[model samples]
Target chain A: MSKKLVEAMADLEEDAVLAEVKALKAQNVPALDIIAYLQEGMSIVGKRFEEKEYFLSELIMSAEIFNEASQLLGGGMGGAGSSKYGTFVMGTIYDDIHDIGKNIVTTVMSSNGFNVIDLGVDVPTAKYVEAIKQYKPKVIGISCLLTTAFDNIKECIQTLEKEGLRKDIKILIGGGPVDEATCKYVGADHVCKNAQETVEYSKKYMGV
Target chain B: MKTNKELYNERLTRIKKAIALEKPDKTPFAPMMDSFCARHMGYTLAQFCFDVELSNKIMIDSIKDLGEVDAASGTSSFAGGMGLIFMCRVKLPGRELPENALWQLDEQELMKPEDYDTIISKGWQAFSNEYVATRMNVDFELLGKTGAFAPIADQRMREAGYPVYGGGVVSLPVDYLSGGRTMAKFMMDIKRMPEKVTEVMDIIMKNNIETMKAGLKAAVDPIDVFIAMARGCPDFYSTKIWEKFVWRYLKEVTETCIEEGIAADFHIDANWERGLDYFKDFPKGTCVFETDGMTDIYKVKEKLGDIMCIKGDVQAGKLTLGTPEEVYNYSTRLIRDMGPGFILAGGCSIPPNAKVENVRAMVAAAAGK
Candidate 1:
């Protein structure tokens, strides 16, 4: 790693994005450079999670940290051209607004450079379609915390399918209500266990 | 022919005797208030939760409707800022929000001690400014009298992202204020300075003496009842954490209640599977413990008998989805099996949409009047 990369890694470990941005700005490290450093940090978190060095609690915190850093950067960092990552529409699905997990996903996606548009909670199916038509998100992440509304995901996926947008949208499902069968039942392209996994799986799903 | 003092003493003795579970003027049916049932009385959950005036109206109306519920209390969430996530209720199908979802603040983003203090000052304002109405059918006045809280602290750390039940018990408001500081930075501190763990707890109860004195002023029945509720939850860092982080503070709180002659209750439903041992330590009758779906309240008969009131039996969903027959059978069986010692309540708060018929059935089943 170069000196700039080493310094960026140190800032990432500090979990201080504002400080990281300041250092980067001082060093003339562009927004993409900071994002790559963030990606490296997240990968480390994911590896630690796989090694059982971190827990769900830590995963969320890390994801949230990344989100705060990205929010600070806003749209000013990528220099010229499109976002170095992509775009995503994420939410707690319709009727199940438990955002701790959803927010974690949003943070990780944003940290990975995805412009995540959080539709908020209890988002209706039409809203997803409208957002897709509006922003053309590369993927759609649906979250839920209620066991009672587990079946609603099927509605969300099917609406996309009916609208002939299923082929275009990569539907990722997660949260307490998500299970292996649920992931398969709702035709989700990927099932994520935590925020790190969500970001990792989205990368795989997006073939990035 | 009886002396005036003798008669006055006798009546007082009778009431005391009744509360002590010996004998009294019939059985005292102090049914804990269920806010989920308040919707049946025609109040929005938003109105019932945030505004005290509306909550009191729903309470008055519900108590009036049941004509059997003895207590005028409401749900507890004073410190839990999980309601903030409720701002996103627009994302779900039928637009339903998940129950008790918490706002898991990012650990790494926790403000430095100085910045946190600044946020703490402004956070209270942020909390007030961020309040949104859930439009739930309920009342406000009755809500206040019974301790329905305004999100003073967003204690979501224990409930969310932690994969565990939490226990929160402190003796003083000042201690609680200080404890909030310790908790907000707990994760970061734990990782960065693992050796300072004991000091973390030191900061939690530093002003116990004054806090206990304040606890005296806020007495209603007692804070012990609320403690019983906490004892039943799961992710509270285990029984060990309880002993280290909060037991002494609770002891101070419970001890104060004892000194003031006020009754208290403890509730820690859902993850109370191993809580029986914790129940054994409580000074009998000083408080009550409520459990939920995963617990067997009957175990208390053998271990916790005469120790504390063990309430909760009807499942929130059963009371919502089950027929009146099912609710009646569930309540009657619990009241009879748990006997006269326990309270008959939902395993947790009854849902806002719970059917009224089911609530009435449970009340009738418990009282049999």
Candidate 2:
């Protein structure tokens, strides 16, 4: 592990992080090892976020830097198989095309070691069920910025229960208008106030 | 019964008094609603999005049903106008999705990094006109029809005994650029080219201020200007970054409002507990700190109660999912604890699926029954 690479990534020194990735590559560092260092750096970023020393800006910046450095190693960090944490399925519920919140959660989740399956915005209930049957993720996040989509979320949760898939995984809901009342109304397990909370909740659920 | 004109004058006085931090006889109910009004009047979302006159009629009818509303933030809405506010494309209910679906902003990286230089060189109006024409996929005929109908809609609301609260809407440069560039890419741009971003923002702010001043001058009843700043909330950035990019411009815009003899209604979304103190510097009675439920409303009252009028924070979830009794009790508590200078409103816009009885309960709370 290169302490410099980890520190550079954690500090969000883009140039330094990129330079270190190239230097380590020149010295024949294995791609997986470099990816591990980058993940370690992201873990530190998450820590700073939890402590409130860094905010969403830092998290996005850190993720951008991590992706750039990963590209230097021939882009092998794309799949769920390489993740240390279990898979996470995420989507914006049906009829809600707002994707900023969903994208943020997925990006932060990916940077924090979860293999995130982003179902994209306006995702229907059947799509979510298909993803669950295929990926069998331990946690799933549903995002909805419109209050109109609340029933859709409730219906989605009910469908999961009907399919006997609700017992095995945790369901988290979030977005601009969602609250504790929304969580109860939608039958979601928890309502994440921000991306960091999503990461923390998923980590605890996964025993990571 | 008082004439509608008399009622309009009385309500306007009450709202203005609240903004000036003086106690009116009663707390005002100036709800900011759109889709909720449509749904309340038994119109589909597609009907509301397609017909501006129908939207106006729905808003008027819904406000009348609520009873004792002092004002509305707006009595009509055009989905096409959203492209201007968000600086991106919108997928209308009838056009892009199911007919009854709520409209959504299709945020993508529509504005490139080089577009900042284009904005700086050509001014916001020129660049934005072209961007809307070419990039936003908006129908020009619909845009024109809606644009022509706005004043008429405002007039109809005034005729129906409701004074409108905000004359026009403005946004921080970051909101437009972030929506155009997408939040992640804009945040990256802030880091990659801080100086250029700062330069571009300065140009945009100048253009916005000029347009705002002109609008205020042109309005027969310019009570306040709605300043949308959800994306620039301090929750999204550290103190240093927020102070530089968000707060600096916010302070400037508020100061401009103060100078222009109008109030600045900050349509703040998301959690903003960390940045409440920054608002303290604005002169007392010059601004309204409107929050969605994400930020603790009680904290706002505790900190800026004596300084500015606090509007809002009936959470959308409560209005949609909770019972009428719950909404009544919450809104009554808000009026009790945060009033003397409080204007009751939804956290942001009332959710389209909100129960009609829940909204009536909120209005009844403001009416003290």
Candidate 3:
């Protein structure tokens, strides 16, 4: 039944997944087990996305469906107990308001059992520093869609370096305007073109 | 040295052969000239966008310097004057954004879900007029001054033996909603109220056909409309969802273009390796496919080269930051790989900051100079 539920979520059949989760719970499946099933489904979705069988909208849909199922299953599915992979600090940079790319990275990362602290859009350098200090996460993701934010990324890296936080965390940058040249210029540890690459990079840094 | 007319004829023949899926003397080059022209002429991008006379002059000068190319180019970005006259959602230079930043269309939900019924009832024109009146602040008199250079620019290019290709417009149902109500809202609509999405899409399909028809009339003979397939990539949706929402409208639009004797070229972005099958449905020799470097142009050539014209895709990053040697090497590989049926252009809008030397290297390689 749980495996079937995973298939439903992976296939992006929203109602079927919802109905299956409810049915499993009605039969007295533990919330924890249901969460596991949901995670398994999301894993498949991520794999499909990485393999190019799925795209952004499908990924977003799967995330949406997961959130819906999790809400139905209740509290234990997210946050500390659910997170096995360490936390990540993520945000679009100060001047850039685009968040779709950031949101997808956050959602995909969190679904993989990484506790992602999304700082929302237009996040200032100081806010990122504060989050890094608070979360002390192993990975930090900076998303910027505009070319103007190229220098701002450098400033963010400089600020982290000044505060002696640069060496501790792995920073990955992604967006429309970012490429290998800009990635080098911004001084990030890595550059990701998509959410799947971000996950792989995060895992690689953590040696997970 | 050859006369300008001789140069123009040579370039035009190259483009024509590529479009017809035949080998040209060499690969044709049409760099996606954007804000680069403004900067090339020692003017700030702001001066280029706002000053009509100066903008046109800079365009003429840039082409003259680039020497021979297949087509006379224009800035792909919409004129900044539109933003000034109308309360447009587009961010323009010297306005809400820095003078150097490219003009960007804001994807805000200016229309709510409730507006769907209103749009369906009133029709696109009436709805659009009302939407524009309520949504944008319009000053037609000021807007008229924005294009004092357009006619003169066209004439000057022709006199210089450069013929501008007709500007093509494409409209996807979801894109119309994305522009008006923002992508986020429209995406939510697709999930939450799918039936309504389809209903609205049907209306948009008819409206888009009308738009393409009008474009054919407005364009030069042998009209080819460059389909703006922005935000309609395979990455954005599941295959099931894309077939339902996007492909249907796209197919209908292409059919209209073909029936009207207008050829279609698309500006496809994102990694759409699995979605190449969609191109197969278009009749052979009826269309051209252009990619934005996200989808591998090599793979595209391998698959569709015999059937349709293929243009594009040098990486924007390489153009902007790489050395001329690097640009030359990459351009050579693309030419060698794509052979005939290829027009060398940036994968998308050439970034405003691309070095002139890099641009020259691309053109020079294609020209065999």
The model with the greatest lDDT is: 2
DockQ of each: 0.06, 0.80, 0.36
**What is the lDDT, from 0 to 100, of the residue A173 in candidate 1?**
84
> Which residue pairs show backbone clashes in model 3?
A56-B235, A57-B236, B87-B137, B109-B181
lDDT rank order: 2, 3, 1
Ten-residue stretch with the least lDDT total in model 1 chain A: A75-84
Worst 10 residues of 2 chain A by lDDT: A73-82
Candidate 1, after superposition: displacement of residue B151 in Å?
24
lDDT of 2 at A22: 98
TM-score of each: 0.55, 0.97, 0.86
Tens digit per residue, CA lDDT, model 2, A106-186: 878887889888899989999999999999999999999988889899999999999999999999999988889889988
TM-score attained by model 1: 0.55
Candidate 3 Cα misplacement greater than 4 A, ranges: A1-55, A62-82, A94-97, A121-123, A146-149, B1-6, B75-88, B136-149, B221-223
Between prediction 1 and prediction 3, which has the larger DockQ?
3
Question: What does candidate 2's lDDT look like per residue over B1-369, in tens digits?
Answer: 999999999999999999998999899999888888888889888899888888899999999888899998786777767877778888888898777787878888899999999988998889988898888868678778888888898899999999999875688998898999998899899999998999989988999999888888767587899999968889889899999999999999999999888999999888899999989988899899998888899999999999999999999888988999999999999998997889999998898888999999998899999
**CAPRI quality of model 1:** incorrect
